[model samples]
Target: MTLGTHGEAGLERGRVDLQRYGHALMGTYGEPMRVLARGEGSWVWDADGNRYLDLLGGIAVNALGHAHPAWVAAIAHQAATLAQASNFFATEPQIRLAERLLELAHAPHGSRVFLCNSGTEANEAAFKMARKTGKRTVIALEGGFHGRSMGALSMTHKDAIRAPFAPLLDTVVFVPRDDEAALRAAATEHAADLAAIIVEPIQGESGVRPLAQGFLAAARELTRRYDALLIMDEVQTGVARTGAWFAHQLYGIQPDVMTLAKGLGGGFPVGAVLAFGERVGSLLAKGDHGTTFGGNALAAAAANATLDVIEAEHLLDHAKAVGEHLRAGLEALDGVVEVRGAGLMLGVGLAAPVSAQVAQAAVAAGFIVNPPSPDTIRLVPALTLTTAEADLFIAWMAEHGTRITTEGTTA
Candidate 1:
């Protein structure tokens, strides 16, 4: 069960028993990676005894990487002291975490924080708030992924993901991404009835694609002009993943509502929606939204510690430096077509659809990367990633690039 004890050993054992004993488990994620036993810093040891530099960082959630001293200590201290009390009582960590989030968000006057357990729940809460204003229509972008919940899925882009659950909530319109003209048309066309315009500053689940900075600015402008709220989904791009507190900051835009998760808790489960301006915050009254484990003491403590370390260690600047190194190295490779993203959230475009093969080669070479799409490899390493580790990964890619291209299919 420990690292180095088995190479491809427990993998077989786990696979067999998982098939037998875990039959009740759904096949949603297609039987996750053999099994990850332990992680330290940016490395994870798999059940097969393979140690890999985790470039994905739990899909941008592990901003501090795995088992960070501060995060671990904070969670342990909070758990031993006061884990959870019912919502009837307030906690210091929760209040502090809320204040910290407001500071990062630069929330407008009358802003309020609504905490939750996951990105889906955050979006679900956002939807209810929008609904309370008696508005039924929402404007979403193509390739945007809100969540899997009924309300959130209605705003997601892909049809294959939504078709099975036919007749999803009505009045959700999907527009092409980064098209200012199209956005203008949609907003003008729906102005009379639209409630909110929801978008991700950088689309992570859709393969690390970034929206044009001006496009985001335009969304803010249009939403304001139309008397609709601008909802920025920062679940994967917030918490310094994009070299900023939130990706929208790069464009100098302030959204009315911002949803955050992933890195907010380092690795702990926490999600929240920061509603700005007096009007939007008050829309969700006492009975409008609630969650059981949203603001528990332990989760808040972890989040507080994560934010403290991010600022104390200046991880935002570190993410920018290391991410630039990684991106530049990938772009220099002979077969790479393009590199896209900001900070640690990166996507590599290959001339061919060999990204999956390249990912396997990377693992063999003692690195872990994610092939979000056949031709795109996404690297969302910890914000605290060091230059040496980044260079090591770059060197591995330089050596294997040609092999991956020659042995695999072209896009």
Candidate 2:
């Protein structure tokens, strides 16, 4: 596993050369660990001949896990059948996915979907649909990460992330997440000038923070009273990740528009904006907005397969059981202050800012956890993660907690 050498047969020789070639080729991501050679189920192998159980699950993208037979077959079949068709022509997968989305939405009637390429694109499309209401203002929750695109960035809460992209789309106000008063005042005051109120049922990138039950309902009611659209960005919490078709369903709230991505296509790129009823659905007309790669045959086929697997496998119930076990174990950690979120989208809050060190230890221990903040460690594992895998992560957390505490004390 030397940094500059190649490996033997079937061993991912690219691991060593990847760092060198990657430095000269790609941007921003830097050198990835072990040059991930292959993956199956909930495990991945790096170039150095190391295998690890994937607790992070590609940031919650690989719902059915790596190299699921169904997904592989679907993609290969679709590739052989039809990979891409210009938006001018209709495709079966696209139509099927659209129908499935509406059924998942369970909207009254006449709900429509606008397909796209990523979570950012989904949010951008939602922003476009919100704008079409002839209003320009939006109220977003603090500590929420929507996407990096202009419109999505505008709704993002972190100052550091937003300051770099200064002079972003204006009229987007951010209020503390789970703070009902601030949301109520802002939405009511600027009701007429507001286009929509965007909120994530469980804030993903800022750490897995779920909005308070009453708080989300208030947003819905406020949007209704102010005649503003309510947008639920489920990019990180949809598609059985939270043991539901969508996270908002847990709170019994219905959003006017719902944006989805992340796990939607398992691993393939796919995004969508679901608008309920005529008032919101008709906002975008022909030629109003579109993406060249949006709803392409390949992405649609992948998404359809992903949905079918979720349904046939009953992964939602599995997620609920495993998530509960994971959360209980995490909450039992000594220095752990609290455990938040539901289903597989769980976050652990530490007594101090040791999450980075804890995450490093977890990496060494073969688990991948995201430290979204100094004190918040988020875990969004694949939906198909087995009970054994869940228990292993719990054990890892207990050991890592002790390691982190000892290191902190010694420091």
Candidate 3:
């Protein structure tokens, strides 16, 4: 955690950037934390040249870690060859990436892909697709996070985010997460007119709670019975974040529609909707939905490179093993309450509501973490994280566990 003095000059420069950033940028993200200078693998350096282990992975966006060679090469090559093309004419990377994504999703040949720039846009497209089914009702899990766009925001469960925008889209019902009974009851009540049921295979924002396998299966059954589409919002749990290509695969359930973003492009902004059905492609006709930069060459190339490196390096197996190590080590910490979630997307519970303090303490101790709520600390570190790094974080927790729970809040 010791910051060397040699980079003091660079740190001052970072301060200048922070000052300019504050004045020029919008306050939607609140105050700046540290001006990050550079990163590689699982580590990042700040403006003051302080080093820290990035445990959050840019909120689960940096799948291959920063400055990965394959990602860098792919971006550079695509930028040089073809940055973007008119949507009227498809680029090779775009076509290739779409085909690759379908294969990864285990989707059949007739399945299709709708690319976009972010998770919110992907959900918006999905929402429109659902409406095209001629059904008026939709179901979403409470506390589930779809996106910030109007339609996606309407399906989200948090009141704090929804209060400012009271009039969200209507007829979107809510069911308790992981509760099969409530989900079934809602389906029974609205099955006749339901368009779709949007569910996160594992609810990431709600403290890493995964829906039960039975619940996911039941959703499929109900949707099939009522002729409704099943939408798996895998924006956070996709791209091997859960040790599988997608979390729904673990449950062995096939959704009609799947939305992806966070890790899809290896830190680049990209989102996609994977629709798989005999007639899926025909639902959204031309001009029914589109984005100017959705399937650009550069982003698709980044995504292709990310997928390429993941398979080449066997990061999926690595994520599984390291996640098990982290789970067991975190549970061994004295004041730790529980460890939830799959693979690298973990949530560490504390004996007290001091997750904020523990996160701050972690920052001072040279680690980056997220305190999404009061009692739970979310860890979505890069899949590239190694067991040694996991062990280092475990040692850090073991050394500072009790203090983190007790003294963390005060600071």
lDDT (Cα, tens digit) per residue for candidate 3, span 315-349: 99989999999999999887888998899999998
Score every model by TM-score.
Answer: 0.95, 0.94, 0.96
What would the TM-score be for candidate 2 when compared with the true structure? 0.94
TM-score, candidate 3, is 0.96
Most TM-score-accurate candidate: 3
Which number leads on lDDT?
3
lDDT of every predicted structure (CA atoms): 0.86, 0.86, 0.88
Residue pairs with clashing backbones, model 3:
none
Candidate 2: pairs in clash = none
> Residue 343 in model 1: shift from native, Å?
0.6
How large an RMSD does model 3 have? 2.0
lDDT of 1 by residue, 1-411 (tens): 111343454468557756764587777877565467789999888756667788989888999999999999999999999988968789999999998899888887689998888999999888887787687789999999999999999999888899999899878988899989998998899888878999999898778899998898889888888888899999999999989999999878889889999999999999999999789888898766788888999999999999999999999899888888888888988778888999999998888888888887676566778998888889998888899888877787777754577556322
Worst 10-residue lDDT window for candidate 2 reads 1-10
Clash count, one per candidate? 2, 0, 0
